[model samples]
Target: MEENTDINLSSGKVESPSGRDDGDKFNLQRKIFVGNISYRVKQHQLTKHFSQFGTVDYCYVVKDHLKKWSRGIAFVTFQDKKSMTRALQATDEELMLDGRLMRVAPAEESKRVSYSEGANWQTRLPPSLPTQTQDGDTCESDFHCSEQVTLPNVSHLELDACGECAIQRLYDDSLMLIFSFLSVKEHVRVERVCRRWRHLAQKSWNRQHKLQFRHMFKGFIKGLTDSILNSLLQRCGVYLRALDLSASPQLLSDLCADSIGANCPNLTELNVSGASVTDVSLRTIAQACPKLRGFIQERSFYVGDKGLTSLFQGCQSLEHVDVQNNAGIVGDCFHSLPTTVKYLNLDHCTKLSDLGLRKICLRCKHLTELYISHCKSVTDQSLINITQNLKRLKVLHMEGSYSQITSSGLKKIGQLIFLKELSLSQNSAVDDGVLVQCAVGCSNLTNFDISGCYKHVTDLGIQALTRCSDLSYLNISYLSHVSDSCVEALATSGKLQSLVARTCSGITDRGTSAEPEHLDTSRSSVTINMYNLSMPHLKADREIMLRPADSSSEEEEEKEEEGGGQSEPVSLCHQSVMAAGAEITSDNEWDVNELDGFECDDYLIGDDPLEEERWSLS
Candidate 1:
């Protein structure tokens, strides 16, 4: 009897420990790569050829659009990993089909071998196949040459047996997926091909309606020139709903702006946040994209009141506006800002004062979210204005070192019962009384981050804010005054999905033990980070389960004499996704220090250039 060489094939119930089921075996998919195939071969032919070693589930030959043959490469998927392995082993027999020695491998491994070591990675036959029936001295070439593809179990294949290439018969969606890998230059060149390619090419262009040219940044000095911008706009701008040229600042000249205003009339969101864009471009953009709901010009230092006034006057439907770092524009344009504007961000406008903010609060009374960070000139008058005018505000971020804002201002803030997200970090105004007031009124608050209030607030304030039934995200990082009681309250609260208590010195063994012990399993997950100092006795509260007498007290004493390792309670209860104990660290999936707790890429890609994945012809 022959010894079985298969790993997990007998019942096909046992899984391969090598993780062969994942798509990494073939990055394009979980398929086997077939190489050195003959040009005349078809999908049915390859399927039949490979069906001997496994149940050939799928087969595809890669080639050009109109080409009648493959690029000498193909892919096949088997019913099981054992079948794939066996098929790979069978390739050692030369696997000659129509006289070409075919090579088979996992697609990812093949990529590494083919690219790094070149084509020598392909294995050759042992010069002859041993058999009792064949003559001992006869070589494979001398005995017989493979002149035709012979599929043993497959007698005839009427479906897809002809030499027509698979690439030419791809559906419209598949063709668009292929064209999506092409660059702007390639898209332009692709249209100059046959009309079928052009139709599919236009569909591919129309697929992504947002025209973000940030990926096309060629160099630090160069950008998408006016001509190229106009060309792309002429092709895709009719369907384009948003245009983002924030990263490609070199394309912000008057001519580029003119082309954008002329071409992208239906655009609703525009981000031209570079220092080089002028008032002329801003005014032109205002005259054009009137349906613009969101406009971001964060660092445009040259833009002044005239351009902003023009923009606000024209874009009456604007809902979200970010003019954070533009110091050139003052409050003279405040009246022009639309009443429909619901979200406004003015983070670092050094020239903006309480007067400007009051004008905005009076005009855009329906504002839902507002951010005014690091603007030193803003005082209690702005907060008062916000409470009186913007009664519908749900999010308010006044997170900068502002001594001008007093407790009275925060008391007025409590009047806005609709507030859900509030940040008063680094401001000295927050105290226990104000927190109690806000907690009583704003029970609907979900996200509260007051990390820098170390001087004034203590456990009294922290506990008061925790009373807000809806508060799930709390960041009391540097609150050195808060004690273990706060941690206990938070654990039993059952609503805190995320807790960031970084340097709260009062959290020791007591706090750590109380967290997991009092954890409310009603909530699906809870992440607690206590990263001041390492607590060595964290496992003191855990109930130990003793084993048999064979591993008795003497052995336990020996282990204890060495070191009975103790685990910190910082590991989130109920198997939360992330945990931090001695130090706050992330497993690259989430950021520990970022305010949102998720990596920037989790929301979007920040600062990193958008590198579009381009498909290489392999």
Candidate 2:
């Protein structure tokens, strides 16, 4: 037997490790035998061709033992089981080498080789063959060939295959079986591996009836280079039914609108809140998206009468219009909307008076939900007009401007039996006299917020509101004059969810002021309180500050002292009654220090009449 030779496949060198072929014979993953190679095929060339499948680090073409001539055979050693399998799959016969095809198959055992020196050689042998001797020759007595073998036994081959071969040849039939048994969450994890996998994992975000644009409000238009915004609008505008551009001021401007008009013609829901838009932006939006149903404009976007006219003219399908924080909008804005307009929010529009609201009631008869909070200009007659004309109105919010609505106004609203939600908070003018009328008129009322109406909100107001059988949510906070009895009635009468009654001194069992501790302790508290008191009260509290009375010479001396300068509280009584509201006013001639508290003066008015003559020069 010739000693096995090893070759370095990467470098193509016939290199052998120390003590080769004795105790450390290389383990073969597949049977390795070489035969029928053309005479020109070199070991290096053969190794290079077969090593494409795996590492063939060692290979040798055998030559005649005596003459050392090419014997048309070679031994190839594969680096790993995978390489061995790949070689088997890739080539069974005629693997080209040196421009000549070679016949390839597993090598058969050498019939004449001796292996009898190894222990238990008899049991390891083929059934009829006996063990061989230690030398290069076989043991003749037991080595007789009884029958010819058909093929080599490759049943124990441990060759590892490449990915494509492993999946197609080894696992193709059972591939679905493996994944069919995995849990849903595990499948999701597998699909989250890369872009391709994520594409497979998610369902359609646009499959629903209405595309949800709420979550996209936060960061959709951030630093989007002008080109990108224009491109996106061009691509996605046609199919878009709802486009909520709320909170995106830059993207809703004139430039964006023009681009959108050229692209998005079917847009239905357009929310461009905080855009600070004028009639121009609205006109562009209305023209671009004629099918628009809902429109939302926040604080900065003042949708005056002209914008409303354009919107009503262009977007006839409009259903809801929210013009919040446009304090300058008069009643004329609502005149343009068709009767098809159902929902209107004019919250914080302080300039819209009763006249404008009456126009709204007359024109927008289909109005179901109306929010006119903080419209201090609206009066009871206007609200009466709404209750009488708009029968469909259900949810009404008139908080912060109660002076407009009196008891008679509540009586008018009684005609709308369909009323559900009502808010009268911060309307100090609404007393128990009117709220009882409201409770009687709108018996179906469910949600109510009646905060900050202190002077007039007595227990009678609370008792009347309790009459609503459907009442569930209520807020009666900050009514400083409301007593414990009102809260006790609410705790038992209605189903309240949230109530904010800050500074409601009368209802809270805790005796502290409802104002925040920080606000009460701040510098403005003392100043604000003294500024509102009567002139008689300031004279009564003479110890707090001095008052200038009748004495021309003493006054001149005090003026001289004041010219020298000192920080002093302004005088609260006597001569300066013109400054009744308690604003700080000190001219260059009247130094702040020369004012009442700076220095003692004989001209100072107080309970003691005789002390008015003594001037403290110090």
Model 2 spans > 4 angstroms off: 1-226, 250-252, 402-411, 491-502, 508-618
Query: Which sections of candidate 1 miss by over 4 Å?
Result: 1-186, 192-204, 214-223, 514-618
TM-score of every prediction relative to native: 0.56, 0.50
Steric clashes per prediction: 0, 11
Q: 216-300 in candidate 2: lDDT tens per residue?
A: 3357556323354455555445766775555345554456567667777878887666655677867987777888888877775
Error of 2 at 168 (Å): 16
The Cα error of candidate 2 at residue 496, in Å, is 5.5
lDDT against the true structure, per candidate, is 0.68, 0.59
Which candidate tops TM-score?
Answer: 1
> In candidate 1, what are the lDDT values of residues 83-124, reduced to their tens digit?
776776784454789876675655433211223221232442
